[model samples]
Target chain A: MDSIDKKLLNIMQKDFPLSSTPYKDLGEMLGISEEDVINRLGKYKKEGLIRKIGGIFNPRSLGYKSTLVALEVKEGKLEDTASFINRYQEVTHNYQRDHTFNLWFTLIAPSRERIKEIIDSVERLPGVRKCMNLPSVKMFKIGAYFSLDEEGEREEQKSDQ
Target chain B: MISDRDKKIIKHLQEDLPLDSRPFKNIAEKVGMEERELLKRIEEMKEEGMLRRLGAVVHHYQAGFAYNAMGCWRVPQEMIDEAGKKMSCYREVSHVYQRPSHPPHWPYNLFTMIHGHSREDCEGIAESMAEETGISEYTLIYSLREFKKTSMKYF
Candidate 1:
């Protein structure tokens, strides 16, 4: 990607315009035409670089409860157990980490009871040995903005030399 | 308290917003409201902390942050808050949380997720974080595979 593309990604990750004509707003900030901004974003989306441009809501504020769950599934039943857990809409992120308690996932549900119900069902599933529900006592930070300008800056410096 | 109309707005806003010059206008039309009113409500939600952010959610690996490790620290109860704040200052640390730790098996209370270009880079960030916080007892758990990762479908 070009430097302009890197800059656009960086800006959109944190401060996407919240206006009637957001593309135009972004275009002005990036010194590109509105059409160009739209095209580039569209291209990035198609290329799987940009997942989505939307609102990230606070689940707790919306009367929801979320928790991180770690489970130790028997080696033979890992695939089945993961698929069973993934069937719930409440389960958003599920990963197999390098630990005895390998299957780790996050769930956001409408109520604590719902969270319990899902966990209970998973524990009953064959090959599931142990489960731990780790809910956040305090959240210090939660932002996932990756700066894409470092490489772009290096390229600029190289060209200047 | 959120009104029914606000729920309708939230439902649409949570989806992938259109890449148009007037994207909100399109959403407003669908929700039977003017563009200006929709913008106002969105701004209010943001101020109220109901909406965390409205921006691009990139694929991290695709964005060049191909490696990430969850650094779990065994912080003393008294120093958790101070250490959490210090850890949050790192740009590489996207999330820092204090969670319940099960004894004998899992004894780490503070969790900071570090993302980097490679495994070594992630470890380096964790090391610096350990040095800064003065908490040496920690473990960096790397994800071996991502089974599923998606945003919550809130209505």
Candidate 2:
């Protein structure tokens, strides 16, 4: 990631223009041709450096409820238990942390009732000793970005209101 | 209540945007809308707060940020705001949320996700945060494995 790439990221993070030629819009600001901007971004995508370049919807506004759950699974069965939970499409992010509650996952569903149903089923999964539902009481920040500037400080994106 | 047209537009836009000068041209065609109309609708959605910023989400591992530290702290209810503000002011800290804390088994109420290039860097940030916030009871839980990470499809 060089300066030009960082500059492109900064622009993309702010607000991608809705236009027939969005890359051209980005190129104009950087004093480069549209083809160059597209080529750089395409390279980034191919290298797996850029995951997705699109709109991030607000889950709550879209009528979805989410919660974070931690699971204490048997030592030997962690992988299997994780795989079992991963089968649920509602579970978006699942990770293993070094703690008694080794398994951490976030589940989003259309309603609180549906989320409850998922938790109910997840609790019954084999090797799961205990399940703690830790729903977000407050969300302080939402958007996450890494700044590629020389100062090593990340750009401060506006927090979710 | 998202319209069918809106859903179709979102499904296409959420994926990797076409790397073309006229990328939205194809999306507009696929969504059965004029290019200008599609652009106008997306702008309207942003104004309506239905969408956040349109951005690039880099794979952190490829970007040299392999350390993903989740700092879970057992801050008192009243201190949540203070702790959150203090920790989140740091650029390395990404997400900060107030979650329910079950006693004994789970005493961490405030959770913050910190990204770094190495374990030491993340731990150092967590340490500094704990020291600054005066929340001594905290653990920086690093993600050992990521089994499933994907966005929801409301359609």
Candidate 3:
């Protein structure tokens, strides 16, 4: 990506235009045509760099309860346990981390009872030894913005060389 | 509380917006509302805190942040607010939260999701966070593999 792409991403991450002609607004800011902005973002989406360009809702405000869960499955049952957990639509993020409690996942449900139901079922799994339901008591931050300036600098240096 | 019409609008907004110049117009058409009304509803949602922001969600790994670790700090109850605020100030620290800790087996109450270009970079950030917070007891749980990662579907 070029500097323009980097700047475009930065602006989008901070606050995307809420106007009717957002792409045009983005184009005016980037000094590019609306078509160009659309094409670049389209390419990025197709290439898997851009996940989605849409509304990020506050789950809590939407009456959803979310928790981070860690499980210590028996040595060989890691894959099986992950698949089982994935079956629930509530499980959004699941990962294998480097710890005794290797399997970690995030669950968001409409009610506290639903969260407990899912956890209870997972605990009943044969290889699952332990489960920890860590719900956020206080959330300080949640924005995941990555500045691409350094990469842009590297790109510029490469072209100069 | 969101109205039934607001839910209909949200169902569309939760997914990807059309890539065209008149994206919201297209959405408004699909939702059987005028573009102005759709935008007004979205604005209201933002004002009410139901919607955080309308923006691009990038794949960090593809965006050059190859390493990410969940830095778990066992902060004292009295110091949690201070420590959490301090950790949240770092650009590399994307998420900072205070959670209940399960003792004996698990004893970390504060969690910060740190991302970097490398594993060492992540560790260094955590180390500096530890230094700044004066809370040295911490663990950086690096994700070995991503089994699943997707946005929540709320209607």
Ranking by TM-score: 1, 3, 2
lDDT of 3 by residue, B53-122 (tens): 7889888778767788999999999999999999888877878889999999888999988877678988
Alpha-carbon deviation at B57 in model 3, angstroms: 0.6
lDDT of 2 at A18: 69
When 1 and 2 are scored with DockQ, the better candidate is: 2
Write the number of the candidate with greater TM-score, choosing between 1 and 2.
1
Candidate 2 accuracy as lDDT: 0.83
lDDT, model 2, position B56: 82
Off by over 4 Å in 2: A150-161
Q: Which residues of candidate 1, in runs, are more than 4 Å off?
A: A153-161
In the range A1-161, model 1's lDDT, one tens digit per residue, is 98889989888877888889999999999899999999999999999999999999999999889999999989989889899999999999999999888999999999999999999999899889898889999998887676666564211010000
| Clash pairs for candidate 2 | none
| Model 3 spans > 4 angstroms off | A150-161
Candidate 2: DockQ?
A: 0.71
In order, what are the TM-scores of chain A for the candidates? 0.92, 0.91, 0.91
